[model samples]
Target: MDILVCVKRVPDTSTNEIEVNDAGTDIERDDLVYSINEWDNYAVEEALQIVDRVGGSVTVAAVGDDESDEVLRRAMAMGVENAMLLSGDAFAGLDGRGVATVLQAAAKTKGIDLILTGAQADDGCAQVGGMLAAMLDQPFASLVNMIEVESDKTLKIGREVEGGEQEISRIELPCVLSIQTGINEPRYVGVRGIRKVASVEIPTMDAAALGLTAEALAPQVERLDYFTPEVGAGAEMLEGSTEEMVAKLIEMLQAKGGMK
Candidate 1:
């Protein structure tokens, strides 16, 4: 099983105080800490575990500028067999479909039997995995929480559905899955691990190398602006004795059409 896991570099929200740039078109990136997206980290770990059991190779790929190499190297440190960086001027400012197109092109260059990606990217629209599957015309399953290797050609996967229920299905090999977090505990990548792969060269591909035409790389969607919406009404604190508070809450709920 040759698996490819899509990853991304994103702002470390926990460590960074994210703010909108003065222009309001994007976040203030200056002086920000960057790291592999939390969800993508889980996907990389899941891919590693799958390869460990099935005796296959795992490759991690990212679509970004030179700054993305760190995220790819981190995955390599986590035991991925390969890492790829998809970058170039032509690849900038791409929307979801555009990203899927680039990844599809890269996947064709490798013998990938399974593709894994986070259910959603921290700074993305959560549409790449499904779109990539559509572009590649492969089977796709999202929100996957469990994976069982039924055979070399098939995989039994568990998905979290509505009402906390799990839906299990058998998907064929060479399919794409958007892995949900909590599927596995990601292994820690310490300084030693990172240093080991720091010097390893990661191959970079551009639109020209991927045979992507200018038209194919064009973004269909455009972001007009990105500003925080105005704050809504403030919350009302129900203060009183427990019984009195319950009565007030019920009255408020009834008045608000939330109850009879």
Candidate 2:
């Protein structure tokens, strides 16, 4: 049950307002607090749980610059046995496919029994798990919430489908699983774990070492613009006495498709 969980570092947008500075292509990230992506936490915990039951190691990997090392240490604090940082200037501005190519190349060389990652990054652009699986030429599942490793090369997995329904199926191993949140509760890193992480030295691998050429790493799609969505014209506020407010609200609602 040697498991490799791919993780990411993303800005903590919940606490701070994001400002676009790179001509709407990216955010001004220097001042933002960064952490392990929320979805990756679930994936890491699930890997740890499975490895705990089956007896193996869990390695967490991240793709980012120097500051991204913090999140890898954080994952080690969560009990991952090892950490890998896939980084290089060549990795900058990589699209989802480019990233999946890097992860696939690295994983192929290092090797693992199962691969797990969040269904999507907090950046909200891609569902990359399937992309990695496709590149690896293995069975792929997305939005997966449950997993049962029936054997070394077999997995019975469950994924969310339509209308709150769950679809479960069995697939062969050496496959990638895109974890959906709620699969399991992610454990909080305590002081002891944090202290351990502080003393750990995670390895760094340049994308070039992964055998990725600059041309191959180029993004497939280009961003035309990155502007904050405009507020809807119909959104308005009513300020008045309670009776007047109620009347105005009712009128507005009636004008729309609400109660009269």
Candidate 3:
């Protein structure tokens, strides 16, 4: 089995550098530090585990600018056999559909037998995996917590559904899966692996290489501006007797429209 795990480089949410610009349409990446999207690390780990058990190869793929190579190398250092970067100036400003189009083309070139991705990227759009699956015309399952490869052609999986219920699904191979973060704990790169793949070059592909054009990959949805939400101080507490405090709390809630 050839497992292709899609990864992404995103601004570290903890850095507090992700902010909307004055226009309120897109995040400003200036002065931001980048890391592999946290959830995608779990997906990569899951792929590595599968290949370890099943005697296959794992390839990590990403769509981004030249800077994305660092994240791909990180995955390679963690034991991925190959890393691919689908990037170009034309790929800039792509939305989910454009991303899926490029990724689908790349996956086809790799002759992938299985596709895995984080249920959602931490930028939090939460739509790429499903969109990619749709573009590939493959069956897909989301929120997967556990996966069992029954054979070269089948998978038995466990997913979490609403109301805390666990659903078991038997999906065919050549499908896509969006793994939930808690599906497995991602492992750290060891010194040996890190040093071994540190200088490994990540192969790059572009829209033109994939026989795609900018118009075809252009975003259906456009970002018009970027802005952050306004911040304000918390409410003042009124010190009083228990009964009086309750009355005051109700008054505050009512004033804030929390109470009808």
Candidate 3 lDDT, tens digit per residue, 101-201? 89899998988989998888865787888988999888999999999999988999999999999999999988999989888888887778767877877
Q: Which lDDT tens digits does candidate 1 get at residues 1-260?
A: 89999999999999999889999899999999999998899999999998889889999999999999999999999899899999999998999999999999999999999999999987658899999999999999999999999899999999999999999999998899999999999998899999999999999999999999989988999989988889999999989899999999999999999998
TM-scores for every candidate against the unseen true structure: 0.94, 0.90, 0.88
lDDT of 2 by residue, 21-102 (tens): 7667677777788788888989999999998887889988888888888888888988898989999999998888888888
Name the runs in model 1 displaced over 4 angstroms. 254-260
Candidate 3 wrongly placed segments (more than 4 Å) = 190-192, 231-260
Local distance difference test values of all predictions, in order: 0.94, 0.87, 0.88
Provide the lDDT at 75 for model 1.
Answer: 94
lDDT of 2 at 126: 52
